[model samples]
Target chain A: MNIVVLVKQVPDSGADRNLRNDDNTVDRGSANNVINEMDEYAIEEALKIKEAHGGEVTILTMGPDRATESIRKALSMGPDKAVHVVDDALHGSCAVATSKVLAAALGQLNADLVICGAESTDGRVQVMPHMIAERLGVAALTGARKLTVDGGTLTVERQTEEGYEVITAATPAVVSVWDTINEPRYPSFKGIMAAKKKPVQTLSLADLGVAPTEVGFDGATSAVVEHSKRPPRSGGAKITDEGEGGVKLVEFLATEKFV
Target chain B: MTFDLTSEQDQLRDAVRALGRRYGHGYFVEKAKAGEHTTELWAEAGRLGYLGVNIPTAYGGGGGGITELAIVCEELAAAGCPLLLLVVSPAIAATVINRHGTEEQRKRHLPGLADGSAKIVFAITEPDAGSNFHRLGTVARRDGDGWLLSGRKCYISGVDEADHVLVVARTEDAGTGKLKPALFIVPTNAAGLTRSKLDMEIVSPENQFLLYLDDVRLPADALVGESLDAGLPALFAGLNPERITVAAMGAGTGRYAIERASGYTATRKVWGGRSIGSHQGVSHPLAHAAVQVELARLMIQKAATLYDAGRDLEAGVAGNMAKYAAGEAAALAVDTAVQALGGAGMTTEYGVATLLGAVRAGRIAPVSREMILNFVAQHVLGQDKSY
Candidate 1:
């Protein structure tokens, strides 16, 4: 099976993010760039399947030239090659437009399977895989924990709000991976050395036969109105003394709405 | 010089983690209990070019340095299968052989050690001498071109598992009244070498041993480097790597404990009609542990960076500091995790308590916390040495 994994370069999950004054967009200053965390699992799962089944893994991502650092990181994880759909305007691209761009780029590879994270840490709308599936006209499964391929058929266990749901799809399909699927692989020294020489084909929006207006902020559907910090939690009531103080705390709690 | 890990260090961390996860904690525990080494994990790691992170690429190593090797330890520890032998074999013994061994020694030992096929455990500490290595009583007497070694080593981990034991012994000349330390490779099957397993309560796979080398003899080639006097610098080169590896192990233990607590408290609720995790009492400690673990992790990475850049002095200080921080962090994290789980924490099923002993090893062996404090006070702070 030939697999293609879609990775995104977003702010580190732990970074503090904010909105910029111009156009009220998210200020990328405090947000350190990294390969989306969930996407790490996706790349790892794809690599595992490729290693088990003897296939080629092509890491696909869309961003500016600097985003190739994320691709370089993915390539270091035993990916056969990488393809970067580079566009300066692609920054701050929403999931819908991002999916469309990735679908357009992935359509050229004719991959048997395309894997992606259910959602980027920056924007947790959880819509990319399904949107890419719609654009590519391929069956898609989201929140998958386990994926198995036997002969040309694919079976996947997807986590749902209720429980887990098992889905079967044809060989050529798109799947969005949950972070719980598997631990991501660390890149080796040899992989880092070799990734320098690996083929990372860079393509512009024109190369994918797509126009600039079709993606990026202009094409994005959702808009962030504002940003605010999560209010700090209130300090709890301290129970100092052991037994008698515990009774006092109970009485205080009974008097308050907390009881 | 730039003291950063470069991209290669990052890659090494990832690869080792992947391989480690394949044969994780469960596998490690089983092999450790069975008195067998995790040979599969070791071989696979070697095949992936990890066992030789700091060895020269010309000698079947990845041609990186101590930083890369340290990353390997941290990643594996995080995966719950920290390779203690990596400290002695690849990091210390292999490093000495590569840098100071004769051409024939390098040809015979480097490839095996690099590939993780031949396991080497280095012994420097003596029971009576304690950490004052200069007072060590292990002796090597000249017998023509060969030497006879007699020594008793205590609390040496992985002696039973090692193919070759690199014993550090002193050679005393009656006339000069001077004692000089020498490094020797004594095969486990060497005549008159007897090892009794140490019954340490720790849960690690490698067991400490009490080695009794009674007149173990070897050829002149068995001596590592030039002579007893020349081994100190070579020995010091390997120690920083060991420290880095230990720091990584501490980080791993901390991460494992924190992860357990994080998963437990994230859903284990109580009052407010949910899990008690909704209360600040449980959540705050977990959060604090998280922050400390991250800080320790940064230090581990920094030490690794300096060591990989060939900054020995900086690496030595950083490695000790990082190890100290990580050890404390891991101990606190595990303790807090146990407390968070409450009654379930003490239960073996939870596995959090199992980490307690492993993390404690970081504080005691390799170098004690008191010893590190002394080093910082004297060398780092310019204060008078207490010991």
Candidate 2:
């Protein structure tokens, strides 16, 4: 079995984030970029599968040059190798354009399974796996809380608001996992040292058969006309007890629909 | 020359930091207060190969050097879980055996040390020696095909948790008929060997002990190297690594204190709704401590690099300086942090005061600041030996 995991480099959500004034895209140049938090779950899942069965796990990342840092970090988690798709044309690409470029790259790897996070913290789009699955003509198993692979079949427990639904698919499927799937392991000392020597194949847009006009800002299907800072949070309502504090607290809870 | 750690080293730092944070200071304090060891954290680190990063790869280690081990020590200490045994066991005991022990000794012990399953604590500070090895009272006399060791060792750390103790004892030189230092690996549970824990004020999971070796018998193979010739060099081999790692831990503790205090003071408000950190009175001390800690860390890096590069002489000078600087910096940082926290600083819930004793002890233990200063004066400055 061969597994390909999608990794993204995003500005640390714990820190202040900004948008570029010129294009309103993410200001990656000035922010601390780290591997997407959810993608760690994906990497862990792929590693678990590879550990259960004898196979290879490849980390597939599509971003700017700095994305290699995140790729190295992911590889430190015990991936066999990595495929980095870096191109100037991929700059300012929208989610759809990213899916197209990733799908094109994945086509060359001939992976039996594709693993990714259900949603990215930066975008929260939750559509990359489905988009890539549609393009590749394979089953899209999204929001998997649990995944089990046996022979040529893939089974997942798709998480839902109420519970989870059992979803089954054949080979050559794309699986997007939720954080509940598994706890990711920290890279060991040996793993960190070995990651530097692991093979990381860097590919360009031309190598993936992607055209500049198809993925850049000019070809993006969606555009941010303008962006602004979120309004600072206001002081919450204060409750003073004058003997009727319990009644007033219940009323406040009812008003806010929190009870 | 570049000061930057290799990418692998950087990753190892980040990885060890993450692991340390997961266990955190709370776990450390809890275990210490409960009279228990940090078993879970130690096992996890062992499984991850963090504890054995400096051991030889052939012995199931990561095949790194003291530079890597220092990173592990500093990162963990920076996370508020300073393991003193890391300085004693891996840094001193493992290095001594790996460097001077015979092939049979390495094959017997290195694998256990590399995997963290076995711990060998160093016992050299005797009740009467007081840093003067020539005056050590511990002696080993020939008994048939073996040796009978007798001595009283003081301030020995982590004796209960260790499987073996590398004892520094004096043997009668056959030709000269004078007492010469020799190292013997004795099982902690060997007959006639008993230990009594000392009540220490420091809040740490590792405890100090006063060990009595009364006619503790050991086999001929128990000698570290093939002969008595390996004794002096073996004893000296562990000193550089011990100093470097202990200094790294001190620097890390300083960082932890500074980080904790900075985090608190940055958000704690008292006057005019401005954080206390905004005032120079509170911030300057932290900034000063930060500078001192950073300086100590640089020296630690230099010492570790030199030692790993086989420049033992240069490493000794740098290592002593690093230990002195780090010891002072850690004490100052922890004290400043406690003061900055004010009333909360005295409280255990604040976590700053919890480290007060440990940092205070760092200035005096293993090697004192005055001793290091004396070393620099004599060795580096070409001054007359003061003591």
Candidate 3:
């Protein structure tokens, strides 16, 4: 029961974000970097699986050196160890390239199972699970609303537009988790202190056997052509609901062709 | 000189903060109102090894110091659920034993203290002695290899919950025939020991006790260290952590009050068609409290650092000043919160008024504000001792 949780560091959800003017890319420097909120769910899920099945949880993340902060955070939540794929060439890598690097590392670690968020708050690509699964020739269960592992099979309630559909995959599979699965537990003070001694291995493209020509901006098939800041929204009109306010509201809605 | 916490420390702070938020003010208030102890939170904290952060690594505890422990105290207090036992148990008793206790003593206590399985409460204050160690009436007489102890301890926290009481007593030095201070591990259920709960004003989860030890007999192994010479250093070692923890709690409580006041004023509208926070009258006091709280926290960090580095003399001054500043900050913050909420602050539903008693008590207990000023006048200004 070896679990590898894929985590990411993104701009803090509460912090203000800006774009780099030169490339119209996100300004990772201005905003404080924090663990992707959805990745917390993934980490929690992995911890739960480990707790129930008796296995060690290892955190796996692909980002710049700054992303190690996010890895430490997951470790604080009681992960046994971590593998950080940090390389300059890893920057500007799309979902496909990112998954390639993750699969390579997971293969090297020989992970029994890989868990990830349905979508990272920063990227919102929602393609890592399927992409990594396709690259590894393993099964994938994405958009998991409810997850349970029994024997060698991993089962999930895949959320759909029309209710949900049950999905199951055999061992050595990829699974994407949603926040609705379970509330993440706060790392105990003991866990934080213990995490300092946990091993964190840093790897580059060479270490992962990833080619320099297959990652980063040069390797990315998609690129941001143009972007702009959204215009500041003005205040909306307020209506007071007096005795005849309902009639006035009806008239206003009729005037706007909404009723 | 650098004030920033390390990345690992920051993570530790965040983790404890999350734990605090999970319990929140309501949990503390409910427990206090129900006259029950916060045993759940305490057990969880202990089980997680947060309580043992200051204990040495070789003792089956986290290899941290008072600096790390203060972070835990401050964050928990900031969430409006300060664990007062932390001040007595880990910060004092644990530190003393780790510093001066024999290998047997350390082995018997440190692991349990680190894991929160066994709680040892510290008792130094007596009805007649107070802070004056020379006036202590507790005496331990050597009878063969064992000792006979008699003492009256007042205002001791968590005596009922603890397995043993670390009693500070006067004993004749083994070699010198003169009476000197010594520390003894007195069992709570010892044959001659009796305890009565004290009626206190503050609504906290911890209860105070008046302990009467009438010729309590203890084995020779009950003594903390081999020599009377080590007692003073052991006691001083405990005091630094105690004062530092007090300062942390005060700063945290002040922060909690200011947050409540600001949150209330930001939303509550009045006759002027503006939020109460927009008014100078409502905002200035909270702003002032914020500054004082931040300054106190800085002092606490400094004092904790000095203490862990074995600079007790320096830590003493900083710890005292930090405690005084933090007390004033807490008083001001809680006062402003009460005024900010007008009527709701008086009610227990909002959870602001419950802090009123606790904040006021923080100023006087552990050590009073005037005593701190006296210490500065005598110790720093080189003036003649007044008391």
* Most lDDT-accurate candidate: 2
The estimated TM-scores of all candidates read: 0.72, 0.97, 0.92
Assess candidate 1 and give its TM-score to the true structure. 0.72
Tens digit per residue, CA lDDT, model 2, B1-387:
345798789889988999999999999999999999998888889888899999998888899999999999999999999999999888999899999998889888988887789899999998888977789999999999999999999999999999999999999999999999999999999999999999999898999999999999999999899999999999999999999999999999999999999999999997988999999999999999999999999999999999999999999999999999999999999999999999999887878888988988899989988888889999899999887
In terms of lDDT, the poorest run of 10 residues in model 2 chain B is B1-10
In terms of docking quality, model 2 is high
Model 3 docking grade: medium
Interface quality of candidate 3 as DockQ:
0.65
- Which is the leading candidate under DockQ? 2
DockQ of each: 0.39, 0.86, 0.65
lDDT (C-alpha, whole model) for all candidates: 0.82, 0.93, 0.88
Best by TM-score: 2
Query: In candidate 1, what are the lDDT values of residues B1-387, reduced to their tens digit?
Result: 445656666656656776777887778877766877788888888777788877887777777777777778878888878788888888888888887787788888888887777888988888899999888999999988999999899888788777899888888856697887678888989999999988877777788999999999899989988766666776676788888888877888788777877788888856565776777989899889888888888877888787766777998888889888888888888999999999888876677777778788778778988999999989999998797
Cα lDDT tens digits, model 3, B17-46, are 878888999999999989898888888888
After superposition, candidate 1 runs with Cα above 4 Å error: A1-67, A79-81, A89-187, A206-259, B1-8, B18-24, B34-36, B173-177, B271-274, B278-280, B284-295, B383-387
Candidate 2 positional error at B195, Å: 1.0
